[model samples]
Target: MGSVFHGDITVGYEDEGSGEALVLVHGHPFDRSMWHPQTEHFSRAGWRVIAPDLRGYGDSTAVPGTTPLAAFARDLAGLLDHLGIERCVLGGLSMGGQIVMECYRLFPERIRGLVFADTFASAETADGKAARYAMAERLLREGMDGYAHEVLAKMISPATIAARPDVAAHVLRMMTATPPEGAAAALRGRAERPDYTGLLSRVTVPALVVVGAEDAYTPVGDALDIHERVPDSRLTVIEQAAHMPNLEQPDTFNAALGAFLDALP
Candidate 1:
């Protein structure tokens, strides 16, 4: 279902279905496999599903720089071009969201739709970004385990993590596996990223906004903010879920995401 290939360094991705092409991008500390539910459902619904493990994360090579998002965007665009896709729907979670924004900016004409799940356009600016960068640097240098544990606690709802140790462990392992430098650099880039609030207002494409009701990282409030800014953007909040609503409430998440893709023109 998936293969590892070179794109700004060797990267891996999974492809499925056979209709309108839709690309799924995973967040940091995880691989494309994270989109299992949504991708499966959308594929069955008749849309081509493409999920790629961005460079420097998952089983791929690491990108050493401050602007990894640019490379990530290029990878998505290149993948589509390589597949001979004239246009495609762009979807992402967290860092994946950042990548989509960059991709849209870089290749606006190729984007047919937008899906943002548990993510937001950058909010920090200037010196405020410095603090976030410093925090990431500290974590990279000496806080991998602790950072992983902290992320685990916040990423999944307390009930989910407490009920499923296996899932919790898998997520933590992914977070821990992220190259510290890569993670730090990626975070720093996101922290200092340009405000896309203005960009959202200009988005002529239909958009889908989804988030975990209990997501502490990018909560429902953040999702609402995006919904308000983007034109014709529909918002869906998945209950009993945290940052990873897709993993925690797969059925609901899949249903909502599939509906969005299906409704797309």
Candidate 2:
């Protein structure tokens, strides 16, 4: 684990392995630890794997004010610059996927390929925005205990929770440990993110879109939309998984990701 200073915010990340660079971004409320499965696998397979805790999560500094998703994108770009990586494959899950799209919008030349997992390109609807704000308020008042329980079923399949108690517990711990201020800021900021459907059609690089078959938030349909719109893209659906397929079904997810990396120039 290492730390980098990006203005007032300090970002924490894990850097491992060697060869072609591959940066993996974690989703909202979770930290870089979530990518342990992919990081170790890909690094051993001859690729540099970087997993960073976003500004408000894990060991990174927390911002009190509203943090636009674009801010997260810029932090990623800065991290690449700090490491002297001119261009590398960028992969992200959930909110991290949205952040990758924002990075593409800001610095397309810096991306070699894209891995979008369990995410969508559409903007938040009115109802969705309202819900996010409501959640934010609830978190500020009540903390993460209730929210963690509410989201657990939607995050992983029932079979996963039953079969892998450790993984389920890890997920809960990650959520509960997240700073309320930071999580709330993210929720509010996400409400203002731009629609990336148009951007998806413009992506020309090799892209892989993966989703859990049972993903409730961004379903398989969302992955198909991304694959169909992106000029050079493939879609893979992991069975018996939900939102966090990479964690729920690591072997399958890593296999698909490895194939994508191998195909990339």
Candidate 3:
């Protein structure tokens, strides 16, 4: 395990193996541990795998300021620079994917490939950003207990949830334990992020658009759009999974990833 210092803040990161860099960014309410499957596979496959705890999530302590997703991207850039990595493959899941897009926008030269799983190009739609704002307000007002229940119910397909309550419970616990501040800040960032459609054209890197078959949060249509729009991107959907496919169906997710990475020239 290795780390990179971002000023007074010690961004807790694990840099393992020795080949092209592959950075993994976890989603909202998730710590670096969320990438356990990815970390193990990528590192052992000879890629220098880098996984960091987003602000306030894991051991990497949060600072006293606005922790918007854009700031999260900057934090990623700082981490890469701190570790002396010039160019690498960047992948993000859910809110983490937004951070990766921001990273691509800010530092296009440093990206070799893109993987956006269960993420959105925009958090708002015809109803405007109210839905996003309301979600944050609900989390702040109702706290994690209510938020956890609501999200857990929506995270997986009803069939999957019924078949494996224990797994569902574990997943719920993971989100519930996240400090409300970080979760709320992430929601706010989603409602406020600029539209990423314009930037996709300039992003010629090989890309993967992964979505869950039952992901009601981020529509499958959006992932299809990503596949069609990104010059060299492909879309793969995992069945019996919802928003967090990597958690609910890790084997399927890992297999897709393994095939994709293996195919990369």
Candidate 3's displacement at residue 67, Å, is 3.0
Model 2 lDDT at residue 197: 98
Q: What tens-digit string does per-residue lDDT give for candidate 3 at 231-260?
A: 888789999888888877878888887777
The number of the candidate with the highest lDDT is 2
Taking all chains together, each candidate's TM-score versus the true structure is: 0.91, 0.99, 0.90
TM-score of 3: 0.90
**What is the lDDT, from 0 to 100, of the residue 172 in candidate 3?**
75
Best by TM-score: 2
TM-score of 1: 0.91
Q: Any idea how many clashes model 2 has?
A: 0
What are the clashing pairs of model 2? none
- What does candidate 2 score on TM? 0.99
Predictions in order: lDDT: 0.81, 0.93, 0.80
Root-mean-square deviation of candidate 1: 2.0
